[model samples]
Target: MIKRITAGLLAGTLVLALAACTATVPISPTDSSGLGSETIHVGIAYDSAGRGDLSFNDAAGAGLDRAKKELLVQATEATTEAENDQARAETLRGLAQGGSNPVIAVGFLYATAVGTVGKEFPDTLFAIIDDDSVSADNVVSLLFSEEQGSYLVGVAAARATRTNRVGFVGGVDVALIHKFEAGYTAGVRSVNPGITVDVRYLSKPPDFSGFGAPDKGTAAARQLISNGADVIYAAAGGSGSGVFEAVAAAPAKVWAIGVDSDQYASAPEAVKPHILTSMLKRVDNGVFQEIQAFAKGDREGGSKRYDLKVDGVGYATSNTALNRYKDDMEKARYRILSGAVKVPSK
Candidate 1:
């Protein structure tokens, strides 16, 4: 249905808009004439909290950095603003028009924007991460079993909590965040149905600032902590920093479970001691694999799933507590991968 819009007309409208100022980070050098050459020019449009978030965007940035160094590819990166549909659309169009092939949009928010822009540049390949809504032939959807990974961390939270009460903090109250909450709650219940689970979302849609606001995360985490939650799992983006900060400042021994990347390695050293484990979503692997596929003259379209069975989703084992619970987590991982245990993604 997105194809109903005239591609030529949309392209014309975006030509002048490309010069508008926006928050962007250039990852690599530019090569204008490398359209069909061996050189792969990647353009990434990141979600809120851009690079250095040490969470989701940073994971994607790691992949691009690897491709630039090892694959010798050129890349340009742009970031989107909070709840700005026009900015998201213009950013994607700007990347395509700038001669970057296989431009990647790095969040579910880019679904509608990518669908609209990919049509204008039929020759340019486009990919979207965490979104499967766009079904264009030129669009490659990079999906992850985030629920599966969240489930693992939930188990860790339930097992490590001294007080049988754990909490969950989400960046936004959307269907995607719901998947994290559902899987986490299910995993916690699977461990001990009697365990109390408290859940809270930072903000609703259209107020995406929740993903970037550490102070808001701190407030939410404190409330959960006061309510007797000894362990907290945060699926918030950069806002997870607030959760970690709160845990670090708590007088009691509070533990935190991070999402997306390994918070133990990515988080600040002061907060590292408070992080019990992390839910590994493997956004870096997905980005690298898609770019590698494009470079091999392969146009892999449709919804590509990254799940636990393929090492796409898993848990970080950097914390010392993992030594005690390694066997249990491994067994849980096997059961889920084998389909013996079904994790809800609601």
Candidate 2:
């Protein structure tokens, strides 16, 4: 069950903060492409760092962009910098009230907010990413098998590491991020039971600033590197940038693995060579599919899982450095897909 936000916590200060921090972008509606005559107005409520994070939020934005072009839908987006539930609830309410159907909330943090605002607007459809706790007829949960993808990256890291040591830097110490850690550790140990795997989280729950803070990511990566970790995987959202920076600056050749999007493609030239690969979460595909389903007149709400078999989650190959591990990664992928390997999500 989803936890309900306390009614008394909706303070005036939160309202003011929401107003000051929320920025909504409105896209002009165009003719619906073959779906129907009705213009589908989609709205997205992003987590912290919003569109420019070049990681999670950008992946969602890519889906919105596809909807705009392929589906010919008008879109509006609002981002919430505040960590509290009140601000997130208001952002969703604003979008739904403005006639945006199938409002997409970019992160699992919006679960409670979606539950609250979803009740108020029964007619409006709400799609939330990374969470499946909201039990509402009007809500659709977009989830991914992050562990499956993380496992593949872990295999790559273990195989590429010369020091037989690797590290994982998570943004927050939450169950969601724990899945990444669990799968990574299992993958490392699977390759070599004696391999040392260092793990660190930037922040804990109720203080999600870790996802947006690059400095903490740098500190964590530096600490792991000092301990002789040659390959590090960062599931730290915007903080992953710092991890890349830290790896690139190391005196010895070190590899960095990114999460969510293809970090190697977006990384700077100096950092590109250091990025081994990224665990592609395919959030963009989830978002696009949700909107596409609604546009096709399927309004039923339920949980949709994007896993390896569906090509929903996997690792990137943009960096040629991953060539040596291609055969091994493919074998691992086949095993996971064929049910020969069970990746843990804890």
Candidate 3:
């Protein structure tokens, strides 16, 4: 009896030790003050909605918040429209340059503006999300794989939809939106070769003006639903709210996917029931990680892609909503992560 008890106790200890090892986070770059960094000053320039859109800007801001709270970083932001992304970046860059502070810019929209800013303020240490739209050694560009996350959502949507038709509502025709659209369309095709994907943009490809217009987004959603689309993955910033409103009013089953942040809680109750899941780009992780990198002396220039390969992008279905689909989701996820299944990034 004593021998049996000893054996059980030893087995339990080994199981707990194995669990701890499996849960350990792989080490990435680190900073000076130990917890990612000491006191790194940062300036955030985001989309037009400022901080409450619960999407890209909010996700990035969350990261900045983490840096300030956990890494002892002092941070500020430049909240302005797409056209003003560069202007705001310049304003922040000036501050960073004068006092030896680092300026962090959010959003892919800042691509064009940040590259020039990096050139003018070579010492400012410009870290941007979604790349600088070009190459610059002074700037650390962070880009994510929206397609990878969107691909998972696409699979879920295809499997869940009874209509076999879905919608893609994009903020702008920029490369970022293209990443979501391309991956979503391909994912649907991968699952069901004949599924119909209706793609629509809130604004034209070159027009950055429509990044936060909700009215246009709602109108676009209604149109997509009218044509029999039951599920839509909306990448349109604030405009996505309008899309949610439209879907909520539908009699037939309608689902509108949220992006960047956990938008499951952002919309009306009726609309949320139909939401399949969210394609989280982990912007907050990117933001905080970049700030930490700067603190850790990993200021190597050029673009750093937060792609699916690095678990940078992923799907977020409600714990309850996806509970039933966990098996399917896990299988798909492992395959993509292992490269056993290729998710097209077209």
Candidate 4:
């Protein structure tokens, strides 16, 4: 079942820091026939990883970049640090007040901030990724079935493990991330009830560094490896690189799985060989589609969901380790799609 929270962030007054402008890519319009004559100003308030994390934030950035190239758009991006939820409201407010019609907020952590600010800006449409609690008329919630995809990678980890033991590394201990852990555990059990799955979280609430700190991820991965986990799947955003590093440094041949985007295609050459697969969450497609709808004068006010049935989430098969299990994975995917298998969210 999908866990829903109704806590509103409109009660407290938030002090927002100035949005640090990291990068801005404005495309020159070459053709007037694209989309429309008026230029759409798109604004994004990014998560802690920002653009270079090669993970969640980068996926969001890819969507914005695509919109700028294909449509007549002037885009602006703002970066956020770990545990800076207060600043999210100001960032969105600034974008709307500065003429950005539809501002996008990345990450589920922005539920409170988006709820609070979205109510204030009823005219300017707001879209938030990974959150669904905000019910304002101007807010668009873009949610993904992370558990469904996480389950697929769990199967990969189970099939690829030689020690009959695997591990899961989560960025934080929250309801949103727990879905990943729950599905992974369920998938591992489905593969082999006798197999052991070791789970660890980098940090708890109020300490969001678990998603951004590579060293912590490396430490968690090493610990899991020491516990005889030969296959480790990480859903820790940018911190996932640390899991890759740990796998690379291990004396024994171990496998690692990535999240959000396909790490096999984006990881460094040295670590690429160790990545078994990735839980592909199509945040890029979701963001790009939402922008396209807005550009076409279609404003989304309700929640937009992306799942396996709709190709919003899946497992990456670019890695050699997972390539051999292609048929089995496809069968499992079909089972999930056909309702024969129900992946747990919590």
Better of 1 and 2 by TM-score: 2
Q: Cα lDDT of model 2 overall? A: 0.86
Local distance difference test, each candidate: 0.81, 0.86, 0.72, 0.82
lDDT tens digits by residue: candidate 1, 36-111: 3455677888886788788889889888877776566777777765456676787787777767788888899888
Candidate 2 residue-wise lDDT, 218-308, digit = tens: 9999999999999999999999999999999999988999999999999999899999999999999999988888987878779999999
Model 4 scores worst on lDDT over the 10 consecutive residues at: 1-10
Residue-wise C-alpha lDDT for candidate 4, range 1-346, written one tens digit per residue: 1111111321232222222222334434773333545667777888767778888988888888787776646676766553566666766666666677788998988878788888888888899998888887799899999999988878777788889999999999888899999888888888898889899999998888899889999999999999999999999999999999999999999999899988889989999999988998999999888988887677759998999988899988887667787776787788899999999999
> Could you list the CA RMSD of all candidates, in the order they appear?
6.9, 6.0, 14.1, 6.8
Candidate 1 Cα outliers beyond 4 Å, as residue runs: 1-37
- Tens digits of per-residue lDDT, candidate 3, 1-346, equal 0001122322222111000001112233552344332345566666557788878888887888787776666554555443554455554454454343466676666666676667777767777777656677777778788888888888877876788999999988877688899888877777898889998998875576566888898899999999999989898877888888888888787887888877886656766776668888898988888877777677667777787767688878673676665566677777788888776666
Largest lDDT belongs to which candidate? Answer: 2
Best by TM-score: 2
Q: Measured by TM-score, how close is model 2 to the native structure? A: 0.91
Flag the better candidate by lDDT, 1 or 3: 1
**Clashes within 3 Å, all models in order:** 0, 0, 0, 0
Model 4 bad stretches (over 4 Å):
1-34
- Once superposed on the true structure, which residue ranges of model 3 sit more than 4 Å away at CA? 1-38, 82-86, 97-100, 268-270
TM-score of 3: 0.84
Clashes (candidate 4): 0
